[model samples]
Target: MPNQNDSDSNIHALLIGIDNYSSTSLFKSLEGAVRDINLVEAFLKNTLKLPTERIRRLIAPNREDTVLLVARSAHEPEPTYENIVKAFTELTEAAQPGEQIYIHYSGHGGRATTIYSDLKGEGQSDEGIVPMDIGQPDGRYLRDVELATLLKRMTDKGLVVTVILDSCHSGGTTRGDYAIRSSGETDTAIRPRESLVGSREELINNWRSLTEGIHRTAWIPVSRDYVVLAACRPTESAYEYSVNGKERHGALTYWMLDTLNTLPGTLTYKALHDRVGAKIQSKFPSQLPMLLGEGDRAIFGTNRISTHYTVTVLQVNASQQRVKLNAGLANGLDSGTRFAIFPFNTADFANKQKQVAIVEVTDIEASSATARVLAEVEGGIGVKGQIEPGAPALLLAAPTDLVRRVRFHDQKQLGEAENELPTQALVDQQKEALDAVRQALAGNGWVMEVQPGEEGHYQVALGKNGEYEICIGMPIKNLNPPLMFRDAAAPREVVQRLVHLTKYQSVQELDNPASELMDALEFILLDQNKQPFPNPSNITLKHGTKAYLRVKNTASQALNVAVLDLEPTWQISQIPLRGNNAAFYELAPQETADIPLRFTAPEGAAYQQAKEMLKLFATRGAADFRWLRLPPLDHVIEKQHEATRGIQSAFGKLLEAVGTEPNAAPVMTRAAVYEPDPNADWVTKQIQVTIVPESLLPD
Candidate 1:
């Protein structure tokens, strides 16, 4: 029970070593031997940051590192199982802060059936860890399922527990023994993978009982914290030494400890596996070490001891939307550490292909977090003659089956294959880069020009500096907001922005907020015509302007509105939503309400200082539902065509004023002529239009 908070010197260690039934039924071999246990005990005491003085031993007589359980003979009458259980229980109860309990069992392991007391005749038998007793005809070995449940419960209290299983039993649902083919003879038994790892009911039953008394316990969530190291796959046997005068320890266990002891500094879980697995294979040539746990979680791109990084995409030119990402070093990052940017098409990588476009860094953007630099290319006949940016040119993928050499800036080969070139991968790399460029173009203030080669492929160039160009030949996407003439367009944009958040899987949590705000804003921007204001439905607020919003909750839930990142110039007060059909208060069930917001815009000089804060809030509020794509926008006349009573009554006044100037906002002053019911009184009032205009005209 080592507490995570304890200093390195305060930790404790508990080691167990058992050896009985040497030949057949008993725990046998070097796993339970004095030599193996002693080596493991010394490694724990020295390598681990545990207090040496508190190390408890239960094996050898008078030794503090051993925990020896009373051995039972296979021939003894009523062989005892309580000794091992009692020993484990005592060790578990004695756990305290800075104490780690290590239970290592190395002995003969075999399949054993669990026999319940009720299954036997009257006054027959009870449940226990049975030993192989040659004297008793009715003795059994141990099953992993039974042992796993007991061990899992004993270490339930957030303990820094480590269970090392060095036995030869199939860890999962596989029978280890199978016949091999002799010459051309067919194999006799099914392989381990073809057999049941464990009964689903048995696993469920054990965990259910383990968590029965615990409060608020459920199935374990897959986490990086927990660690498990198995000697081999559940179906394989752990190999022992066969050479004379060689190390007597099991091949897997010996190498596991040797690698840990000799390796300097801390080894990551994956690294440790590779080292230990390779070392054992070199010596025995067939053993592998299974190391599992959360790897060393070093914070990247930071100095503080925290594990989070801020991923920022900075716009070099806001109007042109020429953006470059600046990924800052997170807290706990090793400073000045070299980092390689390995960009691979993730989709292509899944198919076991290395579609990598290496971007070598020639220079670091001193004011930015620019890492990899792309080299430039020019002066080639039959090749596109665009003068691209120098040093930061992309690592171009050449279409060829055999890649002879990839020469970088200094004629150094980035890569060279002996015979075959990666041509398919080159095609995939180009596709991925093109896809990313297309996604970025869907935003405002950006355009792409792809000039196809006369032979094949195309030359790509992005609009640089402040130039804004639109090419009609390119595929048309929803780059501009729809229904820009009415205030209702804000709510429509909000809904569209909601769709944008789903583009990145990392930001799924914002979906609920996006949906809620979209519904709220739709109710306030509509009038008697059920159509948005023709002139300015969606207003683009300047960098300094302040505006108010009104949201009518047309649903049953009490909607909550939270505004983030409005600073000294832009701020919000407590705006509630409840009323039958009010404009700026709480909108009750089936009611509408408005929110009055007032704030000053930052002065010219102070604008850039608050840009990041403003941008982050606006982006979060928009929540990924972008206007690039919409469900569909229909005119109010379409609803009237559907025979809806409300739409017909609302739009009847506009029809009457059709003969008048078409530019005028059609008035609905005639109450009886336009109202769906003469007695039904529901008048809409306008919130103040102080900062934003009364109506916005389309560009």
Candidate 2:
């Protein structure tokens, strides 16, 4: 053995061996050379604390840095010992001081000395890896002494070198049936070798022929500092089983990788063997992890591992318009980093909430850069976008009418006081528009009422006498965040102006000699509330009675005369009023339309006849089915026609004529009053009346 040297500060390791020969090349096997090399590299980097950036990997002819000599030539023809030596020499020259270098090889092995046979000729074989340099002169195989010398030289320099050999060597040696063919072959199939070892003699002969005293080191104890783990004993052959899954390596590699980070500490050469042995034993119960080494040395380093964390959303402070969250250490998360917020579907917020788009952080004073962000969700029609922290983002709604209160979904009224409430201006505009609609309808005899809805919304209801139900509904507030509105109403005087039934009735006798007869005419004025406006002044009118009718237009807009469709016979002269166009003018509040009426009494008993005729036509329950509803008639005869047909055939015709005529004769008998129904419609009411002797008038 060579002596140790001082230049040993730069410790290095060389792990070399062939996984197979031409007969059993390692390149194509389950635990192939490539797999073992890759495994060892990973073991050092991940399990041994070696930084991946600092490691250099070399493989055969593809990478010229390392010699490909150890690889099978049948599989990889470019590899040769000379090239390998050249590369190693260069590596030695470039190596840095105090640097620990590791070199690994996992392939075929050979022993003793023999002449090498190639396609060309024979040559000296120096423990040469088979199939790389074929056909040479001399055909001399390397002796055990020569190989030992090389190992001694490396050890003497204080470099840690690990060499692993997994191949058949002798007869008595335990050998596996595993075999591999070169990749170059068209049919590179794996099969069992025919050769078998039975006794120690055959084993001894095989060992002696490879190298003199090659098994010498196998008998000595190993050192912890330098190590070598072989696949088999000196007299045994390394074997491999099929790796069943998607694994690239055999059992040994699999166990190492799986347990590397899981293991308690660095696997010193000896400890590695024990651990691997335990693993293998637990699995196979027959095989053990093999070990070969010298000197004691610690193997790997501690503190080499990997880690994982979660992101969660905290409080979403809408008033401030900011979200808060807790964040631990993480990657790719910063204040300005963009993030998308989606509703949590797992629990309380289970897909019920809407998801917002991506947003960037404007400020991050309280939370970490990676902290979860909260987004403000807006409601109402066409609402979108996120709200900032502590911002006013609620949708505000107000009632459209003063009579009703605004209520939330929970039925809570929205108000600050008994009458006044907090609301947006938009609600007020909505109310104004709504009131305009109500007034317009009211002018045409439609009774309307408006009520405030939740969130400044408004509800409109039409009375039984009104024209339509669903009024024009619009949001007072815009369909954006901070939605709000207020209430509005129609002009007060417009609501107040009406037909004064009480005043009309109170002066009945002043305008008519027959006060009791005129007193029977009931009158009512319906207000905006649809409630009856009490007419305290009961009034009535008789034939030839003169009464002045007054009408007032108290609206903010122009009032159409068509609204007051009055009965004829009451001659009316419209008087001009201030603050309004007498023709088509906008009438200001409290303006009155003075209307005068003229009536003329009939000759003889004409007044009595007109009164009876008017009464007959005016009763809801028919006083005379033979008569039509008509305005009170005048003194002048419209035009009389002689009896074209006798009263019998013309009776029905006369009743029908009464309906068509503005002024017709009164029903003088009970038979005339209660005429037989022609259409037989039950909706039509008929009543019986008898003309008494008192009803007749003297000429």
Candidate 3:
């Protein structure tokens, strides 16, 4: 890694944080922006040892509270539009070639109508950061277009830059007690044309000159000179919640600093972003942090730490010989999950000599887990010491008999009238059906039944219509309608559907933290005309429109690739491999594979528009993902093909064990049936597509 001590003088930072807005009614005051700035400034000054003279801060502190005030001169300006632009200009002029620049912005973000005529036809609103003086007559936002141009000026001077925006551009309202980081308005009045940094024509001309006529109609040029770390997606809200049980701070900033403080060594931008994202999602699942542009580069162009699939030890309990980890149910951790502990500074965990101990999970929370040490190495006077906090725990083995919990609710009784109770025959029939369901799931290793109030992956209710209704265990806004199955459906068949639903949820959460191929694999979505979609997340496809997937293997080695379509109607099917008899298609290094796809809406008027996801799994070897495949919930299961005879690979056996019949044992001993290959790795990427009825399309 590039030594921070070696280039302390060459680093320049511009930190902008706004907490006290001029328009309190229009834009709510924030409690975290100034605090975020203070945390980041301390990280730079104390951790990186950067000189005070090289750091510049523009802050709008709350006048009421003197406790959280940061020491600054009276001449220091607030983070107004003009002052922010001037800061960029000063940094560009003062920084020499090959020097690094760090920019951090924490404030309200808003979306407004575009002022430029050329961008009006794009049908997308402009996103910008709200200045502290946004309510003033001459105040205006620093639009993304203008911000891109400013960053381009610095990048054009051969300077490296990294920007962190702890604000979101949409969904302004508060969720529960968490305060959102948006202006809470999307009106055209927010676009201050008169207060723009430069004339529209001048800004467009500068963009054109910088890009050398390429992407001429593009509003924001895709540049490799800088990396942007955004708090959340455009449609999601960035939140300011209480951190460490006291002070409020941006969720992204808090986790980013935590990861940096606990990091064993230097990490690349992509790895750092991934770690921060995992931590943030455990608390705020809706807010997904994004890494854009030049993610392959190391932080500040420093040497990079390779990715490792390991969980950090947060606390050590010497009395119980147990330790707390930073991952739990949210991260798919379960009891009996085994991990191989390594020293805090061990670079390569694959080396057996660096192993410090072995532990198994005993207790779990939403975001944390506790594990008891089963064995440890004897090094009292020798080389490596005992286990400690900040150590990395690499997953070795999970429980072979994993079960997906489902809460079963019998709502049929509520439909019966008080005076018109059902007959004994009817009651007996319902009892028989319930007994069948219990028998079907009795010993199935995949799914288990829970009471109404217990935590589960899905909720299954017997409706008055004599059909089983299944919905997500924790339903949020805008989820698809509940899946229904007729009363005549076989009990085993319902069990199969539940298993498939659990598998789908698992596949969505599957990730390899140690995989080196973070951004190397690309899954591009192409429209009917074979044109690539500009934004895959927002893609909308009408019924009968033929789509395609272009999988690019940018990694250095060949990989076995499989794509599974998770339909809106609750079906998981793999796209067949063209002209390949093998279970998975192998794509050579630097190769691309184009596969045709067809997405149709579910057969129901209620499903006018639904969202589906295409999950792509790339592995170093052939791993049979066929175990994840299933027909729609209403479809009857048919014995189409049998499992391949003879020996099975470790992954294949693992899947086989998961899909075992109910007649098999309910639990298995921890006698290692098969030890997973430590070096074997895989990565998964998913792209969501919206399926709409053809009638909804404009002529």
Candidate 4:
């Protein structure tokens, strides 16, 4: 066994194992409960090195046949509801903040239900654990909700607790049944008709689950503190099997202790879970152990990663913009660590959260590090007027309007003779076309001028894209025909769409970080408590509670932020501003916009829309969606094409009326560029968040 080596530590454990039940009860005897408990005790006492005195045991009464009898001392609590509750109460009173604790349960687990008709939103009777003496009404089963209530007390006291359950409820085990396939979860327990060892002449049995009434729903507590290791999903039953030369034990319990003994204090909760789960599934193939809990916690109270520490407020060098953290090397941290600051005091694990700013460690001492802010998440439109209703940010006059300067690249010369006038007249005609296109765009707020690479932030480039007209249907077919935008694709709109697509794709290639211009900006989604999901791609929701979207701005300039989401059904919609106020955000420099993302719907309807992929676009200036008033992307592109064609036609007739070559070849303009912002540039990023269904949540 690996040694933990920590002799002086404030850690406590409660280990419960019950192998016996009243003969009158519906449950059968189990052969592995005592074995599982004994092995776990060895793991804590011999391997992890917790003192035997700190380990509390609630086991079945001792008998001569027990194989691990030598491991237990004479003085120990017997498995009883009163004793178990008493241990919890005492721990609640004695445990302190930052104290570590372990809770393990190995025993008969059968589903039971208790009526609470008065409770609101209570759908059915709750699932429970079958306790010893469950045959009597006075010895009620320990229910899931009741257990959650008990666990809540420990969490409320701020003690870090880890729970391991190697048993299943909804009682039926098949250890002694006719041979069957072990491909998936099935009951495997020691259930025999009861017969007294001495005086009882007849073996009789009454099922506990049969009398208790099985419930369709299990009421596990909603908590974030207790790290959990459940034996199997609620849909499946846990099993006890013989392995390693006739050794009998609960599958999960055996694998768990084996891993802990091997890795000891060095294994993390996550790492331990992965190794244990893999072993259980590989050997049993039918059973799957589950790991549920907090982020990056280490096993046996060692090497804890503290992500919750506060920033040191002192600014030793204001010009350098350096800061420090409250924690340092002593807190398992070192230099070069990056920290994200949340504007709010709390974090919600289920909401779409935003980040305020990013800071990196520059120098480290024994307890703290010096950090400098790299960039601010800022998007300000610089519009002074009061914002109209439902728009999150004010719309300033566009940057292109402000710069009134554009660089026009005419690639039309690359096209065929039919695309231009006769060769003799083509030079003058092409020059005239360039002038005409340039003047048309300038009339729409672009002045054909740029200082080398500056380009005034917006450039008008056009060319004949025969590909646009050749052998292709609409690129966006999902849009309704009314919004299909069937007209010729405009030079400005087509160019703008291509530019937007390029920028959007750049941010998505996260592996190539350099391709992103606004890599420093982050939009976070969080649960109600302001804690992020362990897996952002697979978010778990709690009863349709509200989620939050936090924006972290580290840049020095303001910005306009717009978040668009694609539903699981492929519908595209923008995440509206708080209270339908604005379409975009005019965020201040080095500021954060923390808004509760309440999708405008009835309470029930919101939870149904949890599966989504969100695209958050941040621009140096506002990109107004209100003017577009478009539907999904499929329709948006089509309509933009239609509008571009309209503008081109108007410009084409104007060129003819304004006196060009008296009679010239028809101009085949292939593309258009929309000058979205003349004053500023924009960047885009997208992330997928999948909210797991409530029915599937273990707790």
Predictions: Cα RMSD each: 26.6, 47.4, 21.4, 25.6
Off by over 4 Å in 4: 1-8, 61-64, 68-74, 120-123, 176-219, 302-612, 615-699
How high is each candidate's TM-score?
Answer: 0.36, 0.29, 0.52, 0.42
Model 4, 487-547: lDDT tens digits are 3433344333333332233223312123223654767877657778688766555434566
Q: Which residue ranges in model 3 land beyond 4 Å of their true spot?
A: 68-70, 120-123, 175-177, 194-199, 205-223, 262-264, 296-301, 304-346, 353-699
**Ranked candidates (TM-score, high to low):** 3, 4, 1, 2
Error of 4 at 464 (Å): 28
| Candidate number with greatest lDDT | 3
What is the clash tally of candidate 4?
A: 72
Which candidate's TM-score is highest? 3
Q: Write the residue-wise lDDT of candidate 1 on 393-426 in tens digits.
A: 1213211211111101111122244222235443
Candidate with more favorable, higher TM-score: 2 or 4:
4
Lowest summed lDDT window (length 10), candidate 1: 649-658
Instruction: State how far residue 344 of model 3 sits from its true place (Å).
Output: 6.6
